[model samples]
Target: MATPADLPDSVYLEIFSYLSVRDRIRSSRVCRRWKRLVDDRRLWRHVDLTLYTMRPKVLWHLLRRYMASRLHSLRMGGYLLSGSQAPQLSPALLRALGQKCPNLTRLCLHVANLTMVPITSLPCTLRTLELHSCEISMAWLLREQDPTVLPQLECIVLDRVPAFRDEHLQGLTRFQALRSLVLGGTYRVTETGLESSLQELNYLQRLEVLGCTLSADSTLRSVSRHLRGVRKIRLTVGGLSAPGLAALERMPVLESLCLQGPLVTPEMPSPEEIVSSCLTMPKLRVLEVQGLGWEGQEAERVLCNGLPHCSVIVRPCPKVSMDWWM
Candidate 1:
């Protein structure tokens, strides 16, 4: 009978592609041939270390052993602990990553400590950078010597970062190429900072401000004035004022709008006002309203009746899972 070891190199590689990073390492121990095949650059094109909580030294060892210039994307999870126990990325490790993964375009870090890491040390080829529930200092965001680091970066997602504040937002305005920005669960960002930063990002096309406590109706007005080209927006903010709704109506290219969280208050725009506003938006296609409970049914009927060409969704707020923030 034939054995598994007899499989062709291509066949083995194909099979290995279906395995997770951990499984690939385990399979490498089976034999020297398997180990050699596991080191193929094609297999490490998109590395996902999200399930691992290894220290920086361990991560450096893993990357040096497996990562190559062909790497395109990397998703990593870090351990968040106090003092020496924290799994922070060091300058040396970041420099190694930039050198080893020159082609890396997307990098996502979750629950990481980046207090000591300068953003400039990141791979310059990166186009998208996401930091979730990470510890980032103000200096880290503001630090830039060349102003050319990560020049290709176009999308940035900062979610639940405790240190994110107005100064950080101002610092980000330097990235004029940014197109998609997601700020979720960031309460320190105020309307002034938002307006100031947004006006500089004329290229931004998608924006999501979710679970922001200070984001009120006036914030929407600022977005309307600064981001006239924005096509998709999802806001979880406080009660909507009439001027906010009116400002949104002027957006010539907006296609999708999602209003939820504090937007569901009894003071929300009436069905007639929402329908009238929707009428002015020539490109409006989807309008979603959440957390309205019984009050939403009437708005649903009115929206569906008023705008036959649009998709309208009205429902109570869905329970968010703990992992949603991460």
Candidate 2:
């Protein structure tokens, strides 16, 4: 017999927390009390505006009002399609955000333009930065700036960033706290670049490289010798090579490995060869092979035979989904 308005402020805020940003905006119109409860900063701690299309001013206003000193994680931006100028985070807005949200630790930007913002202007508290399909000069990040600007930064994910080249790796060495790195769909990085840069990452524990050439014997050998502390690795192997497999055996602390892309090629090692090589990896526990066709089962069986203590998982790659924006 009690109306929804009869719920306490705490209950109303909890309910608002469960609603999406759009739905929460609608609920705010219910009443003054509801509006105030919906505006609570706790609900805006993890803001995700990736699906929304709004002007820069609107986003800035929202951040100033709701996210100041409250936001911890933020994901923004959308696909930059042809003939459409979408709203983007500008340099001034980024500087304001850094000034307002000093506690923000994680940030992900997709298809956003950060070419104008200086890396030193970013929040110093950030620990993780993911930039997917974005336009930003790597030189800004690599330039000689105060190391204290991003002292806590540890994890960096650069996916499909055309501007990210092998030279950028030299800049990353400046981040002494870096621990995890993912370089996917970066065509410019060759085996030589990876070998040269990886030696400086003494503290790196997790590494992933996809769609880049890594078939050379010397490349894998260098990886084995320098990255002795790596615990997890993911690679896109179009054709499995003996030297690549040998590198896996050298990582004494390696626990999880994901090998994706084509498993069988004319020049690749045989299933038996792969299985035999894996036996040298004593501490490996999880092995995942993806993007295989009908031959996945056979590969899984052979891998399991050699690494009896490790769990092997094989699955076909999923179809790519397309998204269209109006």
Using lDDT, give the best candidate's number.
1
- TM-score of every model? 0.84, 0.87
- Show the colliding residue pairs in model 1: none
82 in model 1: Cα distance from truth in Å? 6.0
Candidate 1: segments with Cα more than 4 A from true spot: 1-18, 31-42, 143-145, 294-301, 313-326
In model 1, how large is the Cα lDDT of residue 317? 72
- Shift in Å, residue 275, candidate 2: 3.2
- The TM-score, computed over Cα atoms with residue i paired to residue i, of candidate 2 is 0.87
Per-residue alpha-carbon lDDT of model 1 for 1-326, expressed as tens digits?
88987789999889999998989999999989999999888899988888876767768777878876868889887667546766577777777778988888988888888888878788888898999889987786663546787788888888899899988887777776788888878889988888888878767888888777764586778888899999988777475765677788868899988777645565677778888888898899998877756344666788789989999888777686223422
Candidate 2 lDDT over 141-190, as tens digits, reads: 67366667688889998888888877877678889999988887777777
